[model samples]
Target: MHLNDLSSCSSFTRRSFLRSASAVLAVGPILTEAHFARAAALDAAVPEFSMKGIHLDANENPLGPSEAARKAIADIIPNGGRYAPPLYFDLMKLYAEQMGVPVDHVQVYDGSSAPLHFTVLSFTSPTRSFVCANPTYEAGQRAAEIAKAPIHAVSLAKDYSHDVRVMAKADPNAGLIYICNPNNPTGTITSKEDIDWLVANKPASAVILVDEAYIHLSDATSAIDHVKAGKDVVILRTFSKIYGMAGIRCGFAIGRPDLLKKLMDYGNSPMPITGMIAAQASLMDSDLVTARKKLIADTRNDAFAWLRANNYSFIPSQTNCFMIDVKRPGPQIRNLMAQDGVHIGRSWPIWPNYVRVTVGLPSEMQAFKTSFKKAMDTPAAAFNEMPPLRSRRDGVVV
Candidate 1:
């Protein structure tokens, strides 16, 4: 039967007709012509894609999963058939001993992201607000949105480090303050003294949420010790970065027992047995952590030197990722490199001329260099032009 004739001749019941109409309307245009025009402008701003490219876009460890972690996962495969075991507590105890905090001070979860979300939900209510550095991880901002809490994003300092002073002053009634050490995108660290100053000067009612996702890669000290000292701080540590267990998805939060208990009111689910086993094994493999960290440091240093030699500006980084100032719109540069089989990172709306790149292996870095040069050598007239860059703050690009 012809589809047009079928639609015209079919007689339908009210419910059936409603359902068919709803199905068609569901996929109806949500984006207006103006929206498409804006999107096309954005697409023009981004780089082209290449199939054979190396991906350094996401800050993921190219060398993932230690041998021991893999073995532990294999050993625990049979246990997934059963309900989640009570290994989380045991793992907590091990982490406590290692970190020198009590078991009550630790909350294990699938990943640090859960604890981060829970912390935001638990602390920031409709009246209270969340304060964070601009250009930090967007997860906490998203959580505040879900909780209907206002978010105050203070711009980072000129050096790309968190301006704790400004952030503290911006939101006196902030319920939660988020600090990502070795801050994402820029890969810069805020000093411990600066953090201490923020804590000391912050509103007494506020709680500090320190995300140590990239701490192990940096030389700066952790705020975890402050948590142990009974500060109003909740420190999150993840096995994903240093242990190369991002896939396994295991991380924990360390804070005072009372603060930790508050997070539990949000409820805690049992940790995945396989994930638990992998985390425990990764923790045990101290040698693997040390070896991999050194490798990352050496490789990152080499990449930094190359960037300097090529006169590409970058934020000096202590972490496994850093931002390269491409002297053009980042999305455009990224697309161009993608076409050459090298996918780098997304652009920071705050830093339009910069592209963040993860520290890959030696060969991957070489590919990035080659792809980057090729993209730069190509004329600007060859690709679509993006809108003028906007800052995370009010200032024009320096």
Candidate 2:
């Protein structure tokens, strides 16, 4: 059915659903040209990106949700027909208590992407520009485009961390300054001291957006405390990465109650009952974070060792994904790997020759190693048939 059909669903209006759908297209999967090809291939009768491949493109946990979360989802299946607000309350309360914040300071969503987009729409406009690291996640930048908010993309520092001082001075009329800790693509981190400095030094009218999507995989301190201290900051958390709930879709936006209220100006929706229950179960599992962190780190470290042994250059990552300098166009390498039934992640426009690789199961990573070696071995002349790279006005892939 078309998106307009969503209007018939209770509580879903044409405008709200369209806004949400647009947000997904802007920030969700189908990012680069390669990703667009993969998306189209998925809808094709003879898919190019085979369903049976060792898929590690997205930064998703291959282990799936925790057992407790699985049981919680199963138990809540019967109540799927109900719009259970109580479950949302329970999950919110549990999350707030664990984070040591007031329940009112948290707002749950289907995924952090929605709030991420809405926050940009709420705060940014033609007069107030959006500021962010150049090679970081592009969802907010896309949203800023829709808002007609000018974008100021500061380049990453020499160590691949966000250049926070430069970002703070990017635009005096800045609406939002986005910092994705353990940043996407590179998987490197900006220190909390830099984040603190940015918070204190950013334009007076701007609010800082700190995305902690991969925080569980790293040893970084969260910016949630800034929220509790009533700073003009919003911290985004997702169960998609470490919790293995990407497909299930549960995330949170933590900020002062007033700051969160501004996000509601654009759109809001009821939390999915399954996501709520699973999130609560996941949060209550005390050992889940530590256990999964070590599992991912071990797998990632083994892959790094193999890369080192092979003399391949890669960014030392603290998250579940890392970027490797492929020594050729990233899309060409990605397509070659796809032909070999190994779907990997895409590259950013700023770094056309490097591709991101998500850490998967050990067996999957082994498959990745084999395919990567083969792709690398293939002659650069073999990629002559592939289309040349194209860039949008803002330097993002179209």
* Top candidate when judged by TM-score against the true structure: 2
Clashes of each: 13, 0
lDDT tens readout by residue for model 1, 1-398: 12233333212211222332232211111211122212322443433333345767657787888889889899889878864434655576688889987666776777787778778887997888999998877667767877789989989998778999998887778899999998986789999999999889988899999999888888878887788789999998887787877667788888987776666556554567878888888888869766887999999999988878988888889888888888887767766775666777766567778877889889999998999988888798875563543222111111
Clashes by residue pair, model 2: none
**Candidate 2 lDDT, tens digit per residue, 124-217?**
9899999999798877887788889999999999999999999988999999999999898788999999999999999999999999999999
The 0-to-1 C-alpha lDDT of every candidate, in the order given, reads 0.74, 0.81
Candidate 1 has an lDDT of 0.74
Candidate 1 displacement at residue 364 in angstroms? 0.9
- Give candidate 2's total backbone clashes: 0
